[model samples]
Target: MSLIKLSNIHKRYGKGTNVFEALKGVSLDIEAGEFVALMGPSGSGKSTIANILGCLDSPSSGVYDFCGVNVSELNIKQKALLRRHYIGFIFQGFNLLPRTTALENVELPLLYRQVPKKERLRISMEALELVGLDKWCNHSSNELSGGQQQRVAIARAIASKPLFLLADEPTGNLDTKRSVEIMEILQNLNKDSKITILMVTHESDMAKYASREIVFLDGKKKSDTKEDS
Candidate 1:
């Protein structure tokens, strides 16, 4: 099934003399359980397209269908609710609370869902375990290394059991070896758990980790290629 569909997406900033088109009639269809990477140079609109897919922003003019519903039609509150329930986000900066323990950070999303404290703790622990960081569950964000901190961030993102995972420069801060490890974890999730993943990256090596690659340039898709399994 097509989990995400974008048609004739056009996003403009400002108007008149200062007008700029960040996305110009870009169209895409992402299937459920597919691991796709958006590859582009800086200012190529990969991040803009990622934000649109994540419901972080609405296109100026377009149809964005997510899981068969028109996401642009949703109100702010509805979009927030849907994001919490169905989307998981991982970013370049590893956005974890500095003072919070890894487990607590992972449980933060469950708190918003009003999950029971005990069950939330259980799921958070499981998520940490999935990322091979359960032993550091009590460590604060600063106490962990760059790779470990990113693992905790991944744990937290998956705690909600989201169907789609959106990552922007997920390996940006890690070394090559650590980046490979993180990519392995993501590949495992897509292979074993069937979680759909959409990631934006400038590195071709990183994009190779995905099952498919889509190149973007000048606010439009340049090509889409499916890798052989």
Candidate 2:
């Protein structure tokens, strides 16, 4: 079964004359182990799709199946639990707690799951090591450079061993070199761990790193192109 499936999804905000349709019967599927790049101009509804996929929002109409389960039928609390246990997120902002050690930052989510301290430490360390930040685990977020800080964020996201990752402009704040370095790490994670990745990027250069690129225009899917193997 597809890991994610959205069929004829629609999202509308406001009411009557003020109603805005953010997604117009949008349909897409993401299989396991796929790396998809979501691209679009401002107000293109890509963010709307991301929000629905992350379980932060629901479609106004149509089916959203995740792992063969209908997400549209789930309650808010259920969706929250699903997000907490199954999804990892990375953002343009590192979002690490200032003055906290990298390891501590990575431990926060594990703590929410009530994982034992020893196991949590092990998992967090492994995640950091993957991102090449294990050596800096004890350093405070303020002590790290932008790239290192984003690495910490990535470690934190992966520490739970989430089913997939959602990265929204993760390289937006970095220099070109730093951006490429981050992308390399993500590519390694996708290949080595077989983790599905959905990255939203405005830069065509960054989108090239993904296996498939899907573009949105005027609240509709404009194009979906897969890179040659």
Candidate 3:
């Protein structure tokens, strides 16, 4: 099933005198459980596309159908609901709460869903275990290593069991070895849990791990490659 459909999407910033077209008439389709990578240089609309997928921003003009629902005209509250219910986000910066333990950080999102305390803890611990962070559950974000912090972030992202995972430059801050480890974890989630994964990255090697790769240039898609590997 197609989980996301974008038709003639347009995203612009500023007004007449200082206008900038971040995304120019880009259209794409992503199917459920498919792993995709969006790659491009800076100013190539990569981040803009991620924002649109994450519901952090909307396009200026276009049809955005997410899981069969048209979201182009959704109000802030509606968008927020969708974001909380269906979307999981991973970023270059780990974004864990500074003073919170790994378990608390992972449980935070489930708490928003009103999950009971006991169930929430169980689910959060499972998520952390999936990321190989169960042993560090009680450690604060600041106490964890970079790779561990990102794992905590991933645990938090998956705690809600979101249908889609949208990541922007998720490995940009890590060393090559750590980056590969994180990518392996993400690939495992996509393969084992069947979670749809879409990531925006500038690294070709990283994009190669995805099932499909879409390259953008000058605010438009320049090439799209699908690998069987």
TM-score of each: 0.99, 0.99, 0.98
Those runs of model 3 whose alpha carbons end farther than 4 Å from true positions after fitting are none
Per residue, candidate 3 scores C-alpha lDDT tens digits across 1-229 of 8999999999999999899999999999999999999998999998898899889999999999999999998999999999999999998999989999999999999999999999999999999999999999999999998989998999999999999999888898999998999999999999999999999998888887799999999999999888865
TM-score for predicted model 3 compared with the true structure? 0.98
Task: Quantify all predictions' global Cα lDDT against the true fold.
Answer: 0.94, 0.95, 0.94
Candidate 2 global TM-score: 0.99
Clashing pairs in 2: none
Candidate 1 Cα outliers beyond 4 Å, as residue runs: none
lDDT of 2 by residue, 120-223 (tens): 99999999999998999999999999999999999999999888899999999999999999999999989899889999999999999999999999889999
* Clashing pairs in model 3, backbone N/Cα/C closer than 3 A: none
Model 1 residue 17 lDDT score: 98
**Tens digits of lDDT, candidate 1, 1-229:** 8999999999999999999999999999999999999998888989999999998989999999999899989999999999999999999999999999999999999999999999999999999999999999999999999999899989999999999999999999999999999999999989988999999988899899999999999999999999886
